[model samples]
Every structure is written in C-alpha cells, then in structure tokens.
Target chain A: AQSVTQPDIHITVSEGASLELRCNYSYGATPYLFWYVQSPGQGLQLLLKYFSGDTLVQGIKGFEAEFKRSQSTFNLRKPSVHWSDAAEYFCAVGRGSNYKLTFGKGTLLTVNP
Target chain B: DVKVTQSSRYLVKRTGEKVFLECVQDMDHENMFWYRQDPGLGLRLIYFSYDVKMKEKGDIPEGYSVSREKKERFSLILESASTNQTSMYLCASSSHDRLIPYEQYFGPGTRLTVT
Candidate 1:
C-alpha cells in the first residue's frame, strides 16, 4: 500500500540552527508529496508540495523540500529555524490526478531559544 | 485566502444518538473531504466528494456517512454516535489547478466528545 513515513517522532533544535525533517514514501510510480504543519488546537496548514517539480521546491514560512526519486524521499529543510517554527509537521503522499493526501504520523518540532 | 468553516468548534454528543457535522467552503472547489485527527495515527480520511452529490468512501469510512447535495457544502453523519467516533473532525476543500498542484485548505476543526 502507498504510504508516507516520517521516521522522527520528535525533534528539538536551537532557534537559529538549520532544521531538517526526513520523509520517505512507498509508491508504485512517481508520487505527489506534501508537507503540512499544525499548531496546537489548529488545523493543518500547507507548507510545501512536490509534484513533477524541479526536485527542490520552496514553500511558505521559509521552508523547502528536496524530492529525490531514487531514494523515494522528500525531505523538508530550512536554512534557519525560528521560535515560531515549533509545531507538529506531517508528511503526505498522493498519486494520479486525485488529491487524496495520505499523511504520516508526524514529527513534533521543538525550537529552543 | 481559501476558507473552510465547520459549524461547531466543540460538541458533546450522547452515544447511540444521531449526530451531524456541517462544513462549508467559500471557494468553488470541486473536492471536499472529511477527516478525523488523532494523536499518533495522523489524519484518517472518512469520506470525500468530488462534485455535488458525488461521494466516495475513503480509507476509514465505516460508521460514517457524508452528504454533498451542494457544491460548497459537505456534511458528515454519524448513524449512531459512539465514544470511538469522538475526535477532532476536520473539513477541507481544494480546487484543481492541473498545473502546480492544489492545496487542501482546512477549517479550524471541531473537537467532538461522546458520553
């Protein structure tokens, strides 16, 4: 079955440090991948997506993800992190023209000052 | 901005009682979805509608039903509210761009509790 996996259940980083949240997928063909962030008591917000893109895709809130077909991975990264970036992040995968997002368990990011 | 709204922010329902959760989207998106969010399991799709009156069962559709008589409104129904069904319910809508791909705009979510 097609699925998205974020191996890290929790991660902590200094406010200004570089951040990376790993995501891997298992799909039959080229898949559409996405990253969403959810704050406490709020709904999931779209961060970035990759679908036939230029491998590296930029998204809102100073976030970007690299889509590597060989590794079957689309990892989210940020050159610098902010205190506001502390939230739960989810990795999702979809196929075909449909937009059904299959999401991972998510990674809780804690940014320390 | 894409806006999706759920009728209730919090709800308390009794077990074995019929419950309805309403969702509305201002954007004329062709797709609408209902999902339940849990701590470790992430978000599970309950049902989705591609067009008015066109509904499809999602991965976890049992114990839930959906209504889409209108394009902008989708409703999730619980035939008999149960404690197991209590969770954060989310509503989302998206438009087809066929270009850079589309994003599903989510509502604030309704946290439901069953007694």
Candidate 2:
C-alpha cells in the first residue's frame, strides 16, 4: 500500500520569510510526487510535480520540491512567501499499480505580518 | 488550458434523497476522478474511471456510486444522502500517463450539505 504523511498539522510564518512544509511517503516502486495548494472555497491548484530524473523540481508561485528516494520524502519549499501564499498545502504519492494517488493530511499555512 | 467543470457550487438535500454531482472535462482525458474534501482530512478519492463506463473504487467508496457514460462527463451519486456525507466534493481529470501531461486538473467543486 502507498501512503503520504505530513508531520505538521499547522504552521505559521511571517511574511517574506522562507517556508518549508515536510512530507514523507511509503511506496514500493519509483515514486511520482506532487504538491498542491488550495485556498478557502477554491479548488486545488498544482504547485509542482516530480516524475523522474531530477530530484528537485520548480513550480509556479515560487514553490519548489525535492524528491529524496532513500528518505522516502518529497518536501515542498519556498525561498520566500507572500501573504497570498497563505493556503493549505498537500503532498501526494501516486500509486504505481493503478495510477491512483494517496495524499497527506495537509499542512495549514498561516502568514503573519 | 484544460478545463474541468462541476455542476454546482452548493447543494442542500434531505436525508435519504438521491443526489447527483456532475463533472465535465474538456480535454478528453482518459482518466477522471471524484473526491471529497473535509477539514483536516485533505482529499479522499471516492471513485475514478479510466474510460467511459468503467469505474474503480477508491480509498473511500462506501455509500457512493459513480457514472461515466461519456468521455467528457463523470457523475457521482449518493443513493442516500446523510448528514455525514456533507462535505466539499471535487472532480478532476488527467491524461492516462506522464507522456500526455497527466497532472490532474480540478473543478471549482460542489459543496454538498445533507441534512
């Protein structure tokens, strides 16, 4: 079985500060990882994805993630965050056999001034 | 850009009522998925179809059914709407594999309330 775990339930960051949301997964084969962001009352938008090759991938809105195979982790990071960046972040691991995905519980990001 | 549309932004239904939430994708992607989002639970897949008229159970499939009669449309059904089933329902579609740009495209979502 495949599963995703996000250690943090909630995180608070000051505006213009760097942010990192941790994510780990348990899967058998090579993993397909993705990060999604959701605002209140809005659907999820893809922030980034890592399929193969590069361990690090860049995404929209100044987000990036690194896929560490040995650690079974794919953590999302941002050099600097804006108030608009305050939203829920989700990390998911795609099921190798069925192409389905398993998502973490999500990390709620609160940006402060 | 690929587009995915859900039929309703909000719905209110009584218990035991039959409810249908519709979703449509314009990209003719080979795979479509239905998911329910709850606070602190992230998103739980209800069901998905790889092709028209074909469906597969997801992580949480009980009390739910789905229809995909056309390539572009997928409908999720709740035979007996219950209060516990109330949540924000999301629909998404993607290409079959990475070769075809398989990132899932999501709809704005239907917030269903069963009372």
Candidate 3:
C-alpha cells in the first residue's frame, strides 16, 4: 500500500519569507505525487503534480515541487510567500492504474504579518 | 476547466436521520468520489463510482452507500446519521484520460452537523 507522511503539523512564516513544506512517501515503484491547498472553508485546489520528466515541477500560484527519487520526497517550495498563501496543504501519493490517492495528515500554514 | 458541485454547503440533520449528499460534474468524467475531511485527517474516501451504475467501496465505506444512476451525478447516502459522521463532506471527479488521469477536481464541500 502507498502512504504519505508530512512531518510538519503546522508551519508559520512571515510574509515575504521563503517556505518549504516537506513531504515523504512510501511506494514500491515510481509514484505520482501531488500537492493540494485548501483555504478556510473551501475545497482543496491542486497546487502542483509530478507525473514524469523534469525533477522540478512548477505549479499555479508560483509554487514548485521537486521530486527526489533517492530521498522519496516531493517537497513544495515558494520563493516568497504572501499573506494569502496561508492555508492547509496536503500531500498525496498515487499508485497503480487506479485513480485513487492516499493523502497525508496535512500541514497547516500560517503567514504572519 | 472541470467543475464539481455538491448539493449543499451546510446541512444540519438529527441523529438517526437519513442523509443524502449529491454531487455533479460538468465534465464527462468517468470517476467520482466522496470523501470526508476532518481536522487532523486530510481526506478519507468513502465511496467512488467509475461509471454509471458502477460503484466501489473506498477506504471507509462501512456507514456509507452510494448511487450513480447517471454519468455525471454521484450520490452518497448515510443510512443513519451519527454524531461521529459529522464532518466536511467533499465530492470530487476525475477523468480517465491517459494523458492526465490522476488529477481530481473537487467541489466546495458540504459541512454536515449531526445533533
């Protein structure tokens, strides 16, 4: 079975500061990874996805993720986070032919002024 | 753009009452899923349907049932609502296209409260 682990339960960063959210996955073979963000009382929106090729994948809202095969990690990073970037982020792993995904516990991000 | 819409945004139902959550997708997606989101738990799938009249049990489907009579609509049912089931219900749909098969588009979600 595939599983995702997000070590940080909550993260707080000031505006204009760079941010990185760690995500680790346990899969037997090559895994499809994704990052999703959810604002207060809103549904989840896909931040980015890693399917194949280029280790560095860019996503909407100036977010990017690096798929490191050796470390089994797909961490999300942003050069400078705005106050609007504060939200809950989730990491998910997709395996096999099925379209199902196993998601992590989630990391709540707070952007401080 | 794929759009998924749920029937309700906020629902308050009494315990033991039957609850129905409806979801519809604009795109002709082959898969639709129902999930519950909690504080610590990101999202747990309860049921999913790949096609019309075809349904599959997801990770947590013990207290849930689903119906998919139409290709664009999926319904999740709670036979008897319990306080434990009170949470944010999310509906999502994804295409089976080989090019981009794994991305799921989600609805705004329905917050259900059982009292």
Which predicted model would earn the best lDDT? Answer: 3
Residue-wise lDDT of candidate 3 within B65-102, one digit each (tens)?
Answer: 99999999999999999999999999999989988867
- B1-115 per-residue lDDT for model 2 (tens digits): 8799999999999999999999999997889999999998889999989999999999899999999999999999999999999999999998876663447889999999999
Query: TM-scores of all models?
Result: 0.95, 0.97, 0.99
> Considering every candidate listed, which one attains the maximal TM-score?
3
lDDT of 2 by residue, A1-113 (tens): 88999999999999999999999999888888889999988888999998898899999998999999989989999998899999999998888756577889999999999
Cα deviation at B4, candidate 1, in Å, is 0.6
The TM-score each candidate achieves on chain A is 0.95, 0.97, 0.98
In order, what lDDT does every prediction score?
0.91, 0.91, 0.94
Q: List the residue pairs that clash in candidate 2.
A: none
Candidate 3 chain A worst ten-residue window by lDDT = A93-102
Q: What is the DockQ ranking, best to worst?
A: 3, 1, 2
Candidate 3 docking category?
A: high
Model 1 chain A weakest 10-residue run by lDDT: A93-102
Model 2 stretches astray by more than 4 angstroms: B100-102
At residue B62, give the lDDT of candidate 3: 91
Candidate 3 chain B worst ten-residue window by lDDT:
B95-104
Task: Estimate the overall C-alpha local distance difference test score of candidate 3.
Answer: 0.94
Give the runs in model 1 whose Cα sits over 4 Å from its true position: B100-102
lDDT of 2 at A39: 90
